[model samples]
Target: MNQLSTNWVLGHKVTPYQTTGNYNLVKGESPAGAQGPPPHIHKKYEEVFFILQGQMEFVLDGRQSTVTAGELVNIPSGCLHTFSNTSDESCLWLNIHSPKGFQSFFDAFGVPESEKDAMQQSLAAERITDVLKRAREFDMEIKIP
Candidate 1:
């Protein structure tokens, strides 16, 4: 079993706790109500979003859906999807990607800790493209909605 914790480190706001069996369970707490990762498709892992608190707007397969507390949404593998926090209150949620250990790719190719959050924001396209390429190395495909 592969287990780990990813700290936001400077306002990234999301902490990825552990990964198991194609599922990477990420805990995110954000007051800024910021946007999330860009739309992409996963070749090996299927993703699901389980809302623990507050609300989030999820766009899957180019369609829109809202997830509130205690709700969960499944995004099939190879589907494009993205999520964002649009509420006034802080949003907390779990991003779970199946077939786990996806972080291995991130830890290997992700930007330096200092530039992580900023890079995630400013270079959304490039960053995600790099991530997708890295994921490919691990035989993982990011599903796009």
Candidate 2:
């Protein structure tokens, strides 16, 4: 069994997280209408997402696809991608990125769910700005669209 963290990032609970040479894995739950990061490309990492519950809308490259439970999305290195929980209920999923490193990006922004006003702090203007500014350092090239 994997250990889950109590931290939340961008309103999602992500855990069973770990960084390794081959890949990194994280399980997450996204609330209805919640979105992931801005469209971005990882210069070297390849990512895959397996939806476990509800569904999410993903924008890969410039095309949109709705991925549902029991479905998976494959993203290659340098592909511009982003996703959102567009369904009426929350979505659960597992994500893996090969050649691990991006977990630090979440570490820099994730907040403990038990903290008072955790959500507010996680989405503060300054923090969002900081995320945008430092994202490239994490190999994520944000695409404004």
Candidate 3:
């Protein structure tokens, strides 16, 4: 219901929008070499991703796939997955999760992009640990390692 703001979340710039009980949407930009969240599953939500620029590498159910601009990936609920911007340049993408709630995770842990050193803080060990601790509250079963 409120306007979404952008935040630096785990080495990426994320803007969560269109959040509702039905679904949550986000636009993101990841710098080269940015490794996304660890492999995880959402037992109650299906996820989709649309790549807008550059390329991204994704692991879905143990199968690795390279998605490029204009490509899309659909991950069913309970699938094991993770992603990384493995290209030599930054990549832009959009994501959506059905049966909304995951947006709360980003909102709670993401550093306001407007902060002077948001990028640095977003990846800090302590901040990551805190985020990881509460991940399950948002339906995330993160695989730490």
Candidate 4:
């Protein structure tokens, strides 16, 4: 069988490419004080976050909730959502987006294998208008917080 090790995939100090999917699979791990993206919505893609370890805070539609290990959250398309680690330890989780295509989205907004560190920082700091424009180009709607 083909074994795709973690080292074989693209990653950053904050994240690791444990796996990807024909659909979308989030093999996410975060240290204490870590947080994911700001509140945003993908009008065309559904997402799910499965908490595997530690505790996290999930904010959706302005409501906040804490999720612990073994819990899974399903986010419908077009709903704004975000997550953060509030515990003192590292948190591990999976964030899966359905129907793929988010890889391109992620690459455009943050560090991908093809970009330099500075460029990645620029991508991460991208203006909301630019992000929205890219979203529009991708036929996805992104709502800023």
Best by lDDT: 3
Choose the strongest candidate by TM-score: 3
lDDT of 4 by residue, 1-145 (tens): 2222221011222232434455555466666776555577777888888888887899888889999999988889888887778779887877777777775555454443344553334334344446656666654655565
Each prediction's whole-model lDDT (CA): 0.65, 0.85, 0.91, 0.62
Query: What is the per-residue lDDT of model 1 for residues 1-145, given as tens digits with 9 covering 90 to 100?
Result: 3345444422345556644354667676755466666566676777777888888888888899878999999988777777777778877877776778665654554444345474355345665566656656765555644
TM-scores of the models, in the order given: 0.68, 0.92, 0.93, 0.68
Report the Cα lDDT for candidate 3: 0.91
Q: What is the lDDT of residue 131 in candidate 3?
A: 70
Residues 3-50, candidate 3: write the lDDT tens digits. 588999989999987754688989999999999898998999899999
Error of 3 at 68 (Å): 0.3
> What overall lDDT, based on C-alpha atoms, would model 4 receive against the true structure?
0.62
Q: Model 4 residue 18 lDDT?
A: 32
In candidate 2, what are the lDDT values of residues 23-97, reduced to their tens digit? 888888888888778899999899999999999999999999999999999999989999999888999999988
Give the clash count for model 2: 0
Question: Candidate 4 clashing pairs?
Answer: 26-95
